[model samples]
Target: MQALLHKIIEQPELHAYWLNTLSMMENVGAKKIKKCEHPIFVNEVILKHASEEARHAFYLKKQIQKIRKDACPTYEWQYLLAPKSSYAYLNQLDIDVCRYLKSKHELKHERLKYAAYLLVTYAIEVRADELYPIYQDVLRAYKSPVSVRNIIAEEQNHLEEMEKQLKAFSSEWEEMCRVVREIESKLHSVWIENLHQELGLS
Candidate 1:
């Protein structure tokens, strides 16, 4: 993993791809923040999550600037929203969940959207939990900047918060949560593959 990170960091295109991907994720969070209109407490949690995501994006941008001192990287909206793009998969999954809830006439239910959000957030946090440790290990092994440490810590906090919120509706939303988890599992596999291919690892 350390070797791979070194290779990627040495390649400008690969590095930019990763930085842009992180930027796209922040854009998704911004979109979610705009769409969130749950009750006060839930809305507060959602906003906080979105704000942290935006902050993570800023951190990633700073990291990119460290590599390309003259210019900061930016992600094209079209590329990020492409059908097979990992960003698209993650963002669209949330949209799909919302639609599914609305179709079941549960959209307006007090806890339904909150439950769906928690499930999706949990899946994302889990993915981060798995990936960030590899990044940290690689950075430590390579003596690279460990700026990602704070993001990893925040991701853990997000995971814990999501899990705590999930407990409230787990019984009633068991089947939906299971279904979302299965879908996320598949999407996440594709996302990981996309990242590998982008990094020329596969």
Candidate 2:
């Protein structure tokens, strides 16, 4: 994994696609949050998080210009690395978490949807915390023009914010975290392996 990260950061094609992948994930996150918005009113925090994720998608896309303009003009599979695993990572987490909530908590309708949001976003935030810093470290090491330092700081705050919300949502929030991490862990492993295969590092 470390070898893959080191190699991925140093190469322009790999770096561009990786950033596009990240941007796609961020776009998915924002869209999912918006889909769950209350019909009448939405929480300000939720709105802010969704907006920030959309910004992250845009920010990452814009950074591709630092490499080569229009290197990834769209999120087409041709321009993305491991698009299958990349899209599945979040989609599967959301599906599995919603299933768990419905089965375990009997949550339905808006409750189930919001709970899924909390857990799914929490899991993704945990992932971002680990991913962005390592990518930033590599970028710094290679003197790369692309930097995720700002994203790193925001992701840290997001993790902290998620913890507070999750605890308030359930006394069993830790167990929920355990389940989410387990699901996301498998998806992430598959995603990384796919990236390795895509990069010919496997």
Top of the candidates by TM-score: 2
Candidate 2, 1-202: lDDT as tens digits: 6688787777888889888989999999999999988787688889999999999999999999999777999999988899998888888889998998899889999888888999999999999999888888788888999999999999999899999999999999999899989989998999999988988988
- C-alpha RMSD (angstroms) for model 1: 3.4
Weakest ten-residue segment in model 2 by summed lDDT = 1-10
What lDDT is reached at residue 74 by model 1?
Answer: 54
Query: What is the C-alpha local distance difference test score of each model?
Result: 0.67, 0.90
Off by over 4 Å in 2: none
In terms of TM-score, how similar is model 1 to the real structure? Answer: 0.79
Off by over 4 Å in 1: 1-7, 39-43, 77-84, 99-112, 173-175
Relative to the unseen true structure, what is the C-alpha lDDT of residue 123 in candidate 1, on a scale of 0 to 100?
A: 73
Record all residue pairs in model 2 with backbone atoms less than 3 Å apart, i.e. clashing: none
- Model 2 — TM-score against the truth? 0.97
| Estimated TM-score for each candidate | 0.79, 0.97
